[model samples]
Target chain A: MDKKIAMVDDDTDLLNIYKPVLEKAGYIIKTAFDSSEGLKLYKEFKPDVIFVDLSMEHFDSGFVLCHRIKSLPEAKKSKVIIMTSAGHETGIRFSTDTEEEKNWIKADDYLEKPISPRDLVQYLNEKIFKEK
Target chain B: MKIENGKILVVDDEKGMREGIRRILEIQGHKVDTTDSGALGIQKGIATEYDIYFIDLKMPDIEGTQVLREIKLMYPEAICVIVTAYASIDTAVETTRMGAYQYIPKPFEPDELQILVHRALERRWYILEARRLREEQAKHLLEVAHEQSRMRTIINALDDGILIINQEGQAVLFNPGFLKLLDINQEISIGEPVLEILPTALRDQIKEIFSGKGSVNAIKQEITIHPPAKLVVMANTTPVMGKKGELLGVVSVLRDISELKKIDIIRSQFVDMAAHELKSPLTAVQGYLELVVDKTLGDEPDLYDSYLKRSLDRTKSLVNLINDLLNITRLEAGKVRRELNRQNIKELIIDRLNFFKNDISERALKVNVDIDSNLCVDADRDDLLRLFTQIIANAVRYNKPNGQVNITGRQNTHYVKIDFQDTGLGIKKEEQDRLFEDFFRAKNEFTRNITGTGLGLTIAKKIVDAYAGKIKVESEYQKGSTFSVYLPFAKQNNFTIKNSP
Candidate 1:
């Protein structure tokens, strides 16, 4: 079966650009424009991997949504990735490398924005598929 | 030792006794005058303020006691010694009690007369010296009092709050600023304990200082006080030391840094928002361009056409955002060079409407204009054009199909009012207040697809403000929004059109 992925971002243009590229890599991708819709989409689709933007209607909406997803009993095996534009813009680094950071951020991994689709697929394969 | 010479007067009924006393006193470097009659002696004594007077107990015209009384009344500090032939203890004691320096015997030796003259001169010197010292002390006291009041006036005039507390933590001195900063309405008298009155954070810091646990160096802290109103102050408390290098008290200077703190918060928020806004377009442009460059969708040139078109649109918006940012910075920094001109409001509005003609027709927006022909304002032509362009573009862009955009201008005595009314999706009631803030956009289901830098109204408001004008908005959530701008009328017949070079 093809890998199911969920992506959430406020910018519709970015979602449109990335959706076709990711689907071409043989992944079934679902997208939402905001955190509430993203959460609702997560429950119904139960995608194997989730990508969340660090900011949406509110600055910390992605963190809140990720925490909600991690707290759900059904989200145990699903890997969550938080996409951050803030690291480049604000000079603040967000990472889930340490166990403490993973527990606090409730994210399996993080990626800086302006990420290329080629690198994104490679990162996913290395971290998610190879680990299994 | 240099002898301080004395002037002496001797009054005696016997001529031999008077001459004899004069001879003896004159040899002691004293100038002595003698008279046989008591009335002559009184006249001579009164004329010259002699340091000592030698008056016989039994005189002819005026009695010795009478001469003594008259001289003492004229010069209270005068030293008068009585010389009597009888030498009775009664007469000697009576003359002494009546302001006489001392009494001399009639059969006295030359040494006795000389010694008496020297002692009386010494006594006179001491009285004058004491009087001089008293005058100097009174003058010194007045100067000290004047200096203290001058210091008090200086402290009261300062804008920063100043508080001086004693080692016991009681307020010894405070200025009016202190009361204003701390929001203390009631009068605080000297020696009032101020530990309870201070905010908890500051009180704890002060307590640590008093306990000798805190650093002896000045403790600089930012403290917040809230109750009647929120206030933030930078409290710089230092230990006031004595001459012996011991702590006398603490002096805290509280500067109202609330304004600075507010500006700091706003600056950071603006930076964060600018970063986010700037990154979004770049991300989209990069993603679209990468797909075209890599030819991710299998070797067809036609497949990349749509991506390139979208990338162009994103790049255009990025340029627009940068221009808006620069305009705002220039406006805020007062660096915009403006050329004054008398601009007809009606003509300017029509020109701006022409610029938006394409967008208006594309959306099928109906444009209406009602303005007075002679209505004019004193403004830079380019600034006025930009201001009208922003509002007119918003009316067309935000309007629905077949929507109406009505532009009206009216002139009163001092101002010409221009109103832009659009039949479009208006702002929410809660979001209306934030409409003029930098980078604020009305993001909703309807406005989600609207392409704007979100700085149109902000720039429009700034341009209007530069002309000492006002901008107001009235909106209903689903109905529409009307933005009214009021500009002061240009002076009549003094119109000078100057263009920027």
Candidate 2:
């Protein structure tokens, strides 16, 4: 069965980029620019995979949204991933700055920026198919 | 055998008796000087610094009492024994009151004289010791006064407000800054309970800290007071520890972080302005691309096709950039609005995951979901779902070839948790710290070659905060990473899907 994935990010262009690549690879993609729209689709579509962005509206916007979904009773069975461009060196979750800005993580999983098409699908196959 | 180095002072208006006493003492290794008048006797006593003095009870010019007073004033420890003949015992006893060391009645033996001199010397030694102790006490009092002032001055000059409390939680020392911070004054004292001095809200925080449940910095709270007027202060309470690491008390510094606060507002404004400016053109470009891609003109569309495609790519990039910028700005601002509601956890994950199925298929990455589907959380649903979308996007965007990503969720009493596991190229342990920073990419140039605005995850974290949720990640380089999100649970025993605007 083709793996269906949902991509929730405020950036439409980034979401669309995956569309062409994943569609060519034989998978379906549903995209939303904000968590509100994403949640609606999350309930209705129940896609097999999801991609979340952290800096949606702020440093940890993705974290806030992912947390909401994770807390829901019915959504407990869903998987969410975090996306951030800054590498580990920029002190992603462990910045020495004030506690408020130091950490910005809260999702099912996270990845560095600039994801390649081959790498993206390979990872999904490993986590979803291999684990199951 | 006259007394060596002795010039005896014999003062008596009765000249014959003075001579008799002087002669008697001179015969026993002594040199004697006799004065008939009381005034001259005192003058002699003063001029000669004698070891011993013999004064008659009755003296005319300078009464015996007057002579004794002058002599005692000159030499406080001088030995002056009053000598009285028969029937003048009362006068001799009275003379002892006038600074005489002792009284000697007439018809006394030489042994009596010897004993009296020995007692007088012993008394003088006692006087010296007493004087020494008094001097020492004076110095100690002065030193204590000096030390007390120094301590008070330093306490006043310190940057933070300092209130010294005893074991009873009573304020022993409260500086001006401390008083001003707590809005207390003259009424506070050593035995007064700290609660009485501090505002009600602050007192509650102090109680929490004392119980060791919360940290001072972690609970840094802002309090606004309108007593003297309106003022905003961020109060941080730190427990002061003694040399033995005992909890001495607490010291709180209310530093004004207002400057940074204002700067954050300005930065957020910049982000909004930038998003608006970029989105306006991006929307136009997107519309134009849609129209052209639909072959609206029905002519040779090769040029239009490529132009539209390129425009679409550019617009997508612009959109990512704007979103990233906005995310960074919001998280830095520190305050996230909360619109609470219950959300379906499973639905949110699957929905977010669906966005990238095509990409996952093309890249051949596996996906897994292992979660107890009966979980729900109370939070802003919009922010929650977006949080999942961003993280999942990150996993796909940065996976190694032939890797897998697992998405799992579990429900507990108060929270719902989501876990995104990836078998892709995991983040390096050293580089994990900055993973959430805006626009920070990996050091590898090849990784940088991928198309990303480098703002995805940063925005995701901010969105999580808006929902009052927590996010965490675990990754091992070349192994994979797991990102987890936790949100408040639903109380109505059901999941409702909602989102923030």
Which candidate gets the maximum DockQ versus the true structure? 1
TM-score on B-chain, cand. 1:
0.63
lDDT of 2 by residue, B116-207 (tens): 65565456556656777999999999999999999889988865576655446777677777777656656676677876657766676667
User: Global lDDT of each model?
Assistant: 0.83, 0.67
Tens digits of per-residue lDDT for model 1, B361-388 = 8888988999989888888999898898
Interface RMSD per candidate:
3.3, 12.7
Model 2 chain B: worst 10 consecutive residues (lDDT sum): B492-501
Candidate 1: Cα lDDT at B61? 71
Q: For each candidate, what TM-score against the reference?
A: 0.66, 0.36
* Cα TM-score of candidate 1: 0.66
What is the lDDT for B475 in model 1?
Answer: 90
* Per-candidate interface DockQ score: 0.32, 0.02
- Output the lDDT of residue B259, model 1: 91
